[model samples]
Target: MRNYVGAIAAVCLAACGEPGGTDVSSAPGALELTREADGAASGAWGQGEARVRFASRRVESGVYRIEVRQNGMSLTGLVDAEQGVSSLDGFAEDNGQDTQMLDGDRELLAGLYAALGAELPAGSALAPELKYLRRAVGLWAEHPPAVELQRTVMGEQGRGYTMLCGYAKCNGKFTGSCGTTFNWYSYAKHDCQHGGFDLAANQQIAQLGDHATCDGDELYMSGGKWVCGEPDHQSRPKVQGNCFGRCGPGCGGDTQYTVDATNHDGCVRNGHALTSAYCNDQFTAASDDELYAPDCY
Candidate 1:
């Protein structure tokens, strides 16, 4: 999905001294990327082909965690337009192998950045990274990378009720990687004290808004504070980033109430319920005089 924020700058990396690595920029050809109407992008840089896909979640009103999946690597690029600062948490291969690109994997980092930068939409949020990555490579002059992005209109946000969403471990194990869509939200109430789930991981948050509805089978609420629901796991979008950071300031220690997808009775309580209708009630009741009530169907 297109990121929620706009114009957050990119990170700077030192020159690459790593001798042996996949050198995408060093290949011979112009770098070109075309964003499809569906928002996914693909292109070729030198000898290899690269593709870009995105999943995003709002960190706050203006901050976003935009995961850029290029080829087989997932990059965590934090874009805080409100703050005007951006950072990449790091890169992880599809196999869950972490690569410390900042720690000396310069060649591969620059190559990945080049592909990612080139594949973004003409005015997309990652555009600034292209400039910074060029400077970081130091060899930009020798093999000056040219970025070509097709003029694709980014997607627009939907007009629906916004709700807080997150996922954590279940029964001492995470259902999926933080990046996996199927494992995005925990359908069970897995908390730090009761399940020994890491507090930092549980705090990584996302939102179900823009007219999206939760799965009817896994509906829940936290005493009218916020309602919990499940999105389609297979097709729900994915975001790249470590689940270590909390969603927003002061969201820590908030009690989470989730209906166990496997067994609903284990976590449902007085205020929480399993049906979508009850979820809507909790949502409507939580609003201020229903001023911003979600038009639940």
Candidate 2:
């Protein structure tokens, strides 16, 4: 048995913004392998703005294989600061295992050639009577499962993170390899771990503790945590407003609003306002750190 593994990472953007975001879109269809000529093959796929190629080889009599091996992070625009690294590996093998043996007859080779979309030769070890064998088996072998690592920013602040990594084996038995595996992980600003946080809020304020005020009001009493703003209040301060001033509209976190008493308010003490308003830094930073890894088989 031969051991094989490969990785392919891609981030297809619509020529507008970052590699992984709402604006990004993926092209239809998966990568494919095909015979280019007698005893020759090719593998083709697209990633970002470029095309990628893998090497193919003829291993034995009537047996061919193709392989691409690499870490998912190496690909441009595939991985980013917030997104962790990933990998993929697999192989493609084609052998006439299902076809009946032709006892060293050249006619058997001719049939194989026809099955691969090649013109039959005038004279060969295989006879014209055995030409039907060519159509019996498909040209390319079954591809092994490609590995995938999908990293997503979770939670209201995007402070929470999760990575889903898995492998999907091919369905055909041309080779013995086939199956799937999945793993998950979570991380926060202080420490990278496993799990997530569920937040709660009311119409006026997002109360993580005792005390209430309008969203984006800069809760001096609440240790400076930013609120996501009330959905019902038209005047509610923007959530993740920190990035708005710096990154502009092209970056994540950009929106406008009308200030109203129901949504706007500044903390006050002794007839004077206290703490100045500031957006949550964590959410804005995380939004800028969109990253992704591809699935390859």
| Highest-scoring model, TM-score | 1
Worst window of 10 by summed lDDT in candidate 2: 183-192
Off by over 4 Å in 2: 1-34, 69-297
RMSD of every candidate to native, in Å, equals 19.6, 24.7
Q: For candidate 2, report its TM-score.
A: 0.16
Off by over 4 Å in 1: 1-28, 35-44, 47-72, 85-87, 102-105, 111-297
Candidate 1: worst 10 consecutive residues by lDDT?
144-153
What does candidate 1's lDDT look like per residue over 1-297, in tens digits?
001233543422222122112233434445544433433333334423433333344445554444444445444544453443444433355445544323223344345444443444222443222322322221111111121110111111122222223333331123335332334442222232223323332222232211222343323233433344432222112221221111110111111222211112111221233222322222212211111111121
Clashes of 2: 14
Name the top lDDT candidate. Answer: 1
